[model samples]
Target: EAGRRNLLGLRFPPKYGGRGLRWEDEIVAIGRTANTASLNADGLGIKLGEHGEVHVNASLQTTIPHIYAIGDVIRGAGLAHQAMAEAELVVEALQGAQVDATSLIVPACIYTHPEVATVGLSEEQMRAETDAVIVGEFPLRASGRAVTCNEVEGWVKIVGDKRTGKLRGVHIYASHASELISEATLAIAQGLTIDQYVKQVHPHPTISEALGEAGWVALNKPLHVPRIQRKRLRK
Candidate 1:
């Protein structure tokens, strides 16, 4: 039945057997993009789960104050593009470009049937790592493409540092997780807060717009997802 359902290519997974295991379209897109990007998984082997971090090939620097490292050696997602970006950043810094590597945020893509992509930290990770963390999620049901394609079964989750009100992470379980995560990555990298994102208008009926909605939801002004609605009662 699962095979049949998968073969049928239904937007949702089979309910009889795979009940509750809703396939995320965002994960599917992540995997597809990862494959096209030629990011091999054999080297990484899923050693890290969201916050997994490890440093490899360390060497002290005489001219520079900090040590230099590169490649999949540094723990986290083992995508080549990310590695290349790090390499470039380091090279630029070494050349006295005054680049800031601390602000770089990497995006993750699962690329499964439904697709799953995330940047920075997950809600689970935030809870485990920080005491002051606020999370907000918005469903893809508000997206017109999802409704038009009959594939609106996922959501976007944003994790923010409550103390600083900075976006720490963004996770999405939708049709195009890979593409949608870029905006979130940029926001987190730039230390943009939820309130700032809310002011930016996103085009209607788009999955990317869900990111904006999620940002609003984090700050208590959710749209499309009524469950998290924030209302100020009259005193």
Candidate 2:
């Protein structure tokens, strides 16, 4: 039985796998996947849907020009920071500043063991959208701070555009990754190149240095990790 459990790619039928359950039953088994409880907006006379979401324009203006919406109520990730950013945009638009909300970079973080954080285009997205892409990574095991803290189990990865050398994305899986991702968000927002990122000096023995080192890796001048060699294909 232990050997059977260790077998790879095992499949089970209804009798053993619970496959005979109805779709609704399966949903219950897995756990409910439903939106948060939302109040209808019609009662407020705001022309909202049953979920209390309002459709807004790039400036966050609603169907009624005078009204504006932001946050989870405006159809986006229900994060407070995102809502705050959108609120700022709405204020700017109201002040007659021409705003383009689509270009906004919203950073996301997951607080877990070896925290995960990300901003901007992912590697898969860049490969699909751009002509050429470069990626670099620095493992936490190479980080002095991570080593000292005895929590070296993650990495920092940077994605860049090969044509322009501008940073396209940054992803991190490490202790305090959520905090470190703010730097990445700023880099993507400013269109910083790998060279520029490497130039910014990071404090020694700090986890933040992992980001700078990863930029160095992307530029093929890694300070800590050995460079990876690729086999050239002969024509």
Candidate 3:
């Protein structure tokens, strides 16, 4: 198995409990996490339906003053790291620091055949927030490093706050997108515009260069893609 199993406790099925002649085993570990709730009460909690969207009771609130909530309770991404960032932001706000909680961008990650990771606003959110949201996408097909690493089935997408050129989001679907997203998150955090990233000299023949290439697309100077021909009428 690809995952390591650390033993916490073991349990036998109904058969071993003096019932049916079936066999099953369950093991619970300290680090094991379940996206679903273990218990759902009448007044509070959530449960995932057959289709996987959750049914949540919005009346829930965290134990913090002038800091309403964080984590899965608020309906953003349910990643633990995202929640930690929100917690830190709330703490800073409660300390009378000039902090904006609304600026947070939740990132979603999935580790499957081709790793997936994303940060900041999605395409829909970008369209809803601004009229001039520009997206830059660079495929891994053109990446030399991807070829060298034997992993070339992914993409890097960057969403820029078009009016200000600020980086609004970055969606990385690659081998190590988890590690790559931090830089993008930092860019969004520091308010570094896409132009700044476009001017950056990324090291040669590396997966990170795909980030730089995507930035180039945002700047309208896509390096690998061929120019498109537009029909011109007689002036």
Best candidate (score: TM-score)? 2
Writing each residue's lDDT as its tens digit, candidate 3 over 43-153 gives 344444443334433222232233245566555556798778877876776666666556665567888667888888876798887678877778787799999998887
Question: What is candidate 3's local distance difference test score?
Answer: 0.68
lDDT of the structure predicted as candidate 1: 0.66
Runs of candidate 1 with Cα error greater than 4 angstroms are 1-69, 98-102, 228-235
After aligning candidate 2 to the native by TM-score, how far in Å is the CA of 200 from where it should be?
0.4
Query: For candidate 2, what is the lDDT?
Result: 0.78
Task: Report the candidate with higher lDDT, 1 versus 2.
Answer: 2
lDDT of 2 by residue, 58-174 (tens): 888777778888887767666778988888888898889988777788898888887999998888898898758888888888898999999887888888888889998999989
Name the top lDDT candidate: 2
lDDT of 3 at 37: 46
Better of 1 and 2 by TM-score: 2
Q: What ranking of all candidate models by TM-score puts the best one first?
A: 2, 1, 3
**Ranking according to lDDT, highest score first:** 2, 3, 1
Off by over 4 Å in 3: 1-69, 89-100, 229-235
Return the clash pairs for model 3, or none.
none
Q: What do the candidate models score in CA lDDT, each in turn?
A: 0.66, 0.78, 0.68
TM-score of 3: 0.64
Q: Which ten residues in a row have the lowest lDDT in candidate 1?
A: 31-40
Q: Give lDDT tens digits, candidate 1, residues 1-235.
A: 6654653233444421233433424323342112212323235342322333333322212122464555454554667777788788778867877665545677879887679998898777877877787777776666677888898778788888888888888888887788878887888877788898777788866667888877777877766667434221111
